[model samples]
Target: MPLFTPEKAQTTDQAKQNCVFMNTKDYDDMVAKCQIKPLYVQLNGVVFLAKPLAECPKDKIMLNANQRKHARISLLSNIQVEPYAPQHSDYTDLVQFAIVPRKALPFDSMNSDLLQKEAISQLIHRTVYDQPLTLEFEQQFFDVTAKSQTLQIVTNTTFFKFSVPHPASKNLQLTGDHVESAVVKDSQLMRFVKQTQESMKQKSDGQEQPTDDDNFELDIEFLGVGGCNKQFADIFRRAFVPRLLPPQIVKQYQMQMVRGLVLYGPPGTGKTLIARKIGEILNAKEPKLVSGPEILNAYVGKSEENIRNLFADAEKEYEEKGDDSELHLIIMDELDAICKQRGSRNDSTGTGDSIVNQLLAKMDGVKQINNVLVIGMTNRLDLMDEALLRPGRFEIQVEIHLPDKVGREQIFRIHTKRFVAKNAFDPEISIEELAELTPNYSGAEIQGVVNAALSYAQTRMMNAQAALEGQQVSLKEFRLLKKDFIRALKEVKAGFGKCDDKQIQLIQQMGFLNSAGTTPIIQDIQNYIQTIRNSSIKLGTVLLHSNSSGTGKSSIAAEIAKTCGIEFVKFISAEALVLKAATEMERCNAIVKAFQDAYKVPEALIILDGIEDIIMYTSEGMRFSNQILTTMLPLLKRGQGRLIVIGTTSKFYGMQALDVTKCFYKQIHVDGLDKTLIDEIVQEWCESRNIKWEGGKASELQCIIDREIVTIRALLQSLEQAASGCNEVQCSDFGKFFENTW
Candidate 1:
């Protein structure tokens, strides 16, 4: 057909409907010639499904302002309209689109579903991408942007994802069939709509909108809690949303609603915080918060009555609305306090067991209520009853573990956001560095670190004010420097991965240091520490042995424990156990307790110093304690959390005979000093300590080094005694010392 000049219609229903005006003669001629069904016209490299305007004059084709603007053509430009026949792959029934207003739209002023109905009614069967079609509603223009995949030929299944304005959409979600869902495989346009919808929802909930640069995937973020995006998503998907499904669909599908969830992890890992925010995020009824101890009453039957009271509101709601009631959230902190195993203890009154029975009845009884959601938080999951954790009860268990490096960094940001916003932090304060500095800090500990840093800053400000005379201190000048964080690190120690300074100090006082390149054995021990740290294998054991005593085997084991960088390190010394416990059974009990404590931490290093002493080894008939060995063997080899057990012993051959060597993953032999090493160490010690040594005169020292092995500990002790008060020493003086010592 010959091209006709496009004209903009200022006031016409055809213009608002994105239709092209054509004269009666031209429309009849084109329809008869092409016989195109669901007529489509292409202009200016863009395609649009066109509608005929019957009120137009003959020989003229009309272009509304929206159609002309969408094609980027002017009124004076003549355009050739071609019928669009889409290929097989170029069609899509559903198009997820977005509506961007010229300004922010107020809540309740527009309906998202109605706007979608109008846009889809006009632009269906049109291939559109990047070009936006304007729809006027309530004297406001909303730009409807859709991709080519979403805006193709419309079908009966054609559905658009429409997002409502904040606060208004909280109660008025899109009705009937086109609500937000991932039923269609997610596309770029669909992802955009999801992000926009979540953003609006968050704003409606009165939450701080996430910045464009924030990369957290989950929709919920609670104040004073970080690194729990995944856990929150799991709880919402598994426990919260299922209870909100319409009763008819749930009944037809024969699906039981998820009513209970258990959040268990190490203390200070944010389990309680997540439980408290469940009701706030879901916009459900205010959660009935109760501590596990608070549920128990001193009087008989009162505890069971307290348990029944928690479900009273939900029971009433279920009676009124059946399956259509609003969700009722009940969060119980320290759940293990009340939910102990049913027969774990004998109660005279049976009050505790009855409380458990009452809770079970309320959660999953024959007359079940579907409106209630229970979130239980506990530090000790093993103490809870097995029946409570079964599928029909609190089946969803989420472990709120210690945060990783990225998670720790996010937690630091969350805690320090207010300080950062106020510009109270110095330029050198790096959140990433703070995260690295704290390896095993929980969410609560990270918050404590921030508070500690602020305290340091406050102390510095007070000192400055005290030192200056007639000088006013300004709050704006309060800056948190790098030194404040360093000092904060000292104040707030993580309970999990803490270095034992007292044990390290005792080792230093004993004058055993592997820090210098004194021997290749020290380097070998360091490599074992690094291997355990990097390995994915969760459980491992290393044994360090020497044939002789005072060979620094225990010192090397302590060094390994210090450097392993695991969350827990237990130094179980046989000497300390003997001192603390008089009976042999008590000593064995203490040894077992140490291993059990190590299991509670995610990653741990246990140093069994003097393993022979713990097993009560005696050379005279090759006697040892079988009970202690039995207690230590399974604990060393059992695979659970990430654990590395370092065992040091002076009796290598004895351990081999007992088949204890086979239990370890790796074994390294530590050697005493040879003759050549002894000669070098004596000369260096003499020079460093400002003592004079006449080498030729020390015949006894030379004879001992050549004929017998000398350990570092033995040599150092003799040197300290011989050179007690003398600035000058002779080799003949060593012969006098050996005469008395050897």
Candidate 2:
């Protein structure tokens, strides 16, 4: 008889306890009619344990809210009071299985293990299906679901999976075969459970286990690496770690394992360190650390043979273990040394091409091995062969960029942790300040800074001992000071923070431009620089031109480059061009090389001082080297890397005639100082240097600015000449000095 009802069950506490009550007579009839005593009621295709309720109506069955929700029914439902029997004859005393909560629970508030054990205890001596089981935790009962299959619990059950929601459900998409072995201790399920429990215990005990989001149970230790948490996360997600699931699970899901990844970035940014650390952290066999140059040989076929030998063990392991093999790691540094774009190699020997072919065959050839993970590190990712960068080869590429301020702080703390723990580091040294000071510093460079600081402290210790003359001195007294770190900054140069000190000195020497006459022009140039910084375009060019010579155009250019905060400030002056190269082609080549070098770094500023002189511009025949002019135009417009070019020239009309003015993003004409501006500059300069300057002969100084195109350069040179001979620079001395100089 149909006995289930669609009506909501009564609110009695007893009905809420995962129990469905049935009428006494109907239950007795069903039990008697069945060949075996009825133990479960099958309602709406779901089975539940049957319990008799004397008060229930004879025509109806009672179900709790949980039962109705699991059943997914609304109206009147029919039920069969059926008996359960084991289908498999070799039923063991114990079964291993995994369970997932049908809904989210506060695992943090409850004893997770106790809840799992309680759920296991309830299924003892009962027939279990691959369906929901009501389990109690902290006096609250909930349904725990498993894979959509059946399992018969004969005597006892052990949970092989628990919370944080298994990765297989999301990452690998587990099938029935993943949980099919409902055997005793020797089953794959039991092995997996044991490994998970061990891993969880290690994590709970405050050990640094491999990142758990991807759920590959391995021990990873990046002892000295810092500022690369995101990169490591990507490696785990897109590389070999995600494929660390059991052989059966992987086979059932038909997922391909990640075999190769490329880690490329600026030198000293920890690409090689990350690769080496990954090799150390994985549970794979010892990694083969071969540099790109190591594969090259003079003999024919030898380089290819060397490449094959690197994969020899992995191939053999795959042959023996098939899909059940342990992982093999191969880390290759300087990968661009051999993998330059195919057919671009200039060598006649063709050794580089053979090495690349051998690597491709080993990584993704016919009958490829599934157990090897190749990690290639290079700073020049653009030089790698395109074929090796596609999917199923070195498919995953992660750029290990230089650490930011926060990452720099982390690297500093990591490097100085032992010193801090030993109380040898200064208590007042603000690490945040150091991080701010060391902009664009790589992890290795940060380590170098720490080492340099230590060297300073050691030097102080030796000096103290030398002064004591064989007297005992406490080692703790030789702690690193704030000044030591400050001094160390000068000693260690970061790869990205490579600035020229001569440019800074020149800017300092050109301090006269801070007067009222030049402030607006300086501010305008600063605005242009800010626009370049905010825009998506990588290249920006500005031209500072004047109608007359000695207008301090080069000084203004140097000041702009120095104060803008770009670490790489290069001055490509005509003197440098002439001194470095004699011929016009050689000079053009030098100019091209300067821009190319700037592209290697993330940001740079190139000051083309005296642009007319560099191009050999002359009034005679309107002649300038067309070769240099052509090279300079494209380089100024080249949109690669974060580059800002400031070109200075006195011959504005000549540049315009040659069409070179169009290459600049902005053009500002610099004007010479007028009479009133010259008076203000002279007064400030005298007060700054403590020289007496009363404008008793101010009218004579006016003649200095009275010329048709008198530049700031001419006025400053006159003042310098007057100051060279006397204790005070008076306005009267300017006329006599100009008479002698001109």
Candidate 3:
């Protein structure tokens, strides 16, 4: 039997008010041909609406055209989006768009010169008008074509950013027979659809806040399953740890079971894995994995019906089993697809809003089903609906952050255990050293690193077999070497290494002894930052200058920006950009674009790393464009917006020309660490390395610094070597470190 009564479209006026007007300019008969359902009609002076096929008076909802002539769709429900009845759809799960892209919209460029960038943006904006819509979902139905020009777009997330590579037309048409779009199953289409939404949201938001999935802490009890410790901590510990306790005890204390648990982190950080484990560990009964489009229907009312149907089984089981009911686990992967922040998209057709309303009602519904548990996972945590993350909803929100050094070590051991057990991996494999090298590698990335090394070893064996031709290659003799691991480490880079409080504290402590010199350097910069914050100083660029060898002026500048409580810090390393962008124009554009991005965030700190490179100062001649310098002066001046620009320069005088030097509020000199500061650094390094630093050792370290050290970088290196060697810097070690130094 049908769960609920479907509403009908009453009149043309009602249609104008509720339904999207089908303005078929090219095809007039298309509207008539379309299946507009819940169609109301007056048959022989009686107004009537047809019921669902499950609970209907007749077999067909629509009668002959002669009788249907007066039948107008009072409400457009039961509309068959597919040419045929959707075979893949589940009544309990609601609408499932299982279509795959046989053909896609050309996003390369617009037909002619008349197409503006805004026009293309408008096209995309228009395309995403209905539902919690995604590009791929829309792409399945329509083809975005220009008048004459060739266009292309890239959906290159993970490897590259999804961006509009070329301009598109203003009146770009969307017309196609969307019948043959199904290439894969329902779950895949929904994944592609939601992923498209993520890309679209990112493109629209302007600010690209990077997702962090570096390292994860794994449960010690689950060594074979070790790597995602933080994931387990955030999920199982908070949500299910209490479930393990005696039911009577939990009830006596009025212990509340979490209604919903959300595991939000970067991609490949084991959010989904955590959810799957919850189901496995608890042995949840009939655990439902609802992708975004599971409840979304093309027809009105049908989608809502689908939402109701999803909970029907759980509701029935709860009533039958009462308090002794088994847990009904609902794992909603990519929660952002259906439950994004309310009213985020202005052009929303209320379908997403209705879905959220249904979910909210079900979660906090009148008839309490304590047995049901909803676990949501998403890469885009910020985009999820606020109400969904409220106290009664997904109350326990834990961040699955990147693991530290120790966490990485655990991850390494787990990933390499298979080979270790088989003796195919050498015992001499330095897991600690490998962990250190893979600083910001995610759990998945760490697995990749191990797999990469294994691949190399396999390749080596294969090569040997091929070269020998007749000789039998020994598989047991071929083991993973240090070089293979090193090669993998070199390939994978630590992503998004932001400057935080630790970096700031490191700079804060490492200062000269005297109050007059470098000790006051941090204080001076602090004062400038305060001035900018209070709006007392004419907000502009501040230069950190140093003639001292390896003085770390750039490091100080970054630390200053971080310490100043600035949310938006755009660290523009001129050297990083200038090297990549060969032309002077390209270099300027890169810098200017970064500067513009900084302006997007109010009270932003733009750190100009290696200022000399931007100015093209080599003490001989300046080859950089004068236009760039002029453009930079006003931007550096902080003429508008709460902006603070901090730049570092080894040669301060070289910036005297190009009018850039005059822009700085003050030039603070960064001096090398004094003897006291050196000792403090050495002590920390020794403790971190598990080396004793007391009595004779301290004196030896001080002597080495006082005699040979010129910078904190050099001091740390010398101390590290000394601690490893004999817990004290030998006089011979000092001579070897600085053979030619005064």
Q: Who wins the TM-score comparison? A: 1
Query: What is each predicted model's overall lDDT from 0 to 1?
Result: 0.71, 0.70, 0.55
Give the per-residue lDDT of model 2 (tens digit) for 581-686: 9999999989987776677666788889888999999978998888888888888878577898999888999899998889888899888766566667777777
Error of 1 at 741 (Å): 6.3
- Candidate 2 structure lDDT: 0.70
Superposed Cα deviation of residue 281, candidate 1 (Å): 1.2
C-alpha RMSD values across all candidates: 14.7, 17.4, 25.6
Put down candidate 1 lDDT per residue, 1-742, tens digits, no spaces: 5687676664645655655667667766777777876666777777776656666666556766656666788776677877666665456545655555656555444555676676666666655565566667666666666633233655544666544333333443344444333111124323333544565476467876556542434633334457787787677567644443433355568787787899988789888877766554553567799999999888888998898899998898767644435568899988998899998877677777888899999999988876777899998888899999998889999988887787798799888878889998788989999999998888888889889988889988888888887487898989988998998888898867755678765654445543323357657766776776688887778888888887777777666666556657778887688788787789888987666656656677888888889889887799999988888888877856777888888898999898888889888887777655555666677777878766643355665555465666666666667787988655666545644443
Q: What TM-score, computed on C-alpha atoms, does each candidate reach?
A: 0.68, 0.67, 0.44
Which stretches of model 2 miss by more than 4 angstroms? 1-222, 245-249, 252-254, 507-513, 531-541, 565-570, 575-606, 613-644, 683-706, 725-742
Model 3, span 195-231: residue lDDT tens: 4345445545777555547532224323244455555
